[model samples]
Target: MKANKETKRLFVGGLGQAISETDLQIQFSRFGEVSDVEIITRKDDQGNPQKIFAYINIKVAEEDLKKCMSVLNKTKWKGGTLQIQLAKESFLHRLAQEREEAKSKKEKSTTGNTNVSEKMGGIDFQMKAVPGTEVPGHKNWVVSKFGRVLPVLHLKNQHKRKISFVICFSE
Candidate 1:
């Protein structure tokens, strides 16, 4: 996929399973400032071994990155031909997108409870603040997939209700 404009992190796939982060970082440092390198590892249950992939965060000057990518793409490292490109939107960014989609779906599903609170930890909470009421209405009420209304403890006047985290079930 084409890199987003602000993307400076490179995704290094086709990595030899034995390759380490330090080796990857050292190899890519020649192109620009190597700010960070992350190697993701997950336990392969069937294989019973760690499967690894790497992401490198480089801080090359804006124009220099294109040059770096042009020269380094398809280069070999650690016994594997490298397939590199700018990293996609991060996990947190993806979470925000999910939250927005959930919010829109929630609005359509309910009586247009169009009062979701600002994002906290990339999660948009339910907002029950009435327009003119002296007491804050509710915060973070949970609604279930099967239409079970679980009331979470949103402590302002301390509504004594236990609720599950609200989420949109429809895709």
Candidate 2:
């Protein structure tokens, strides 16, 4: 699959069971700034392993990504030929996107509740503050009100001179 412009995650296939995430990270680090690596595996009830692959996220230029894929793809390592390509959107991420879209459509259909609060990904909470309310230490306030804070977005209306905050909670 083609790489999304906003993401630099790569899918690496044909990995031997012996290869670890660190091994892949170290090898790919030479091409770019490796951010995350995960080696996928499935084991049977008897503890015998099956299905081996990996996903690696690297922050690199477009040219560097091409270089990396070209140089490493089909190379023999750890008794398997490496198959490197741009990673597709993860299953969890896709599910979240679909849920978010559904929620958005539902919201548009019904318009009664003034409260603007939503739960995203079953963990993160998005809370919108009432317009024209000033919150001091917004980040700290969110942390104290909620268990943990992920991101706080402040939206201001120029015409109305009103301010609002969209706080996303981690917990």
TM-score of every prediction relative to native: 0.50, 0.52
lDDT of 1 by residue, 41-78 (tens): 66676765455678888877656677877776788767
lDDT of model 2 at position 111: 52
Find the candidate with the highest lDDT and give its number: 2
lDDT of each: 0.62, 0.69
Model 2, 77-171: lDDT tens digits are 99788999898878777757766885787568545533223333123333444333334334323432322333446566868675645565331
Clashing pairs in 2: none
Taking every candidate in turn, the Cα RMSD to the unseen true structure, in Å, is 11.7, 15.5
Candidate 1 wrong stretches, greater than 4 Å: 1-7, 42-45, 48-51, 93-171
Model 2 residue runs over 4 Å out of place are 1-6, 44-46, 95-171
Give the 10-residue window scoring lowest on summed lDDT in candidate 2.
Answer: 115-124
Q: Clashing residue pairs in candidate 1, if any? A: 151-163
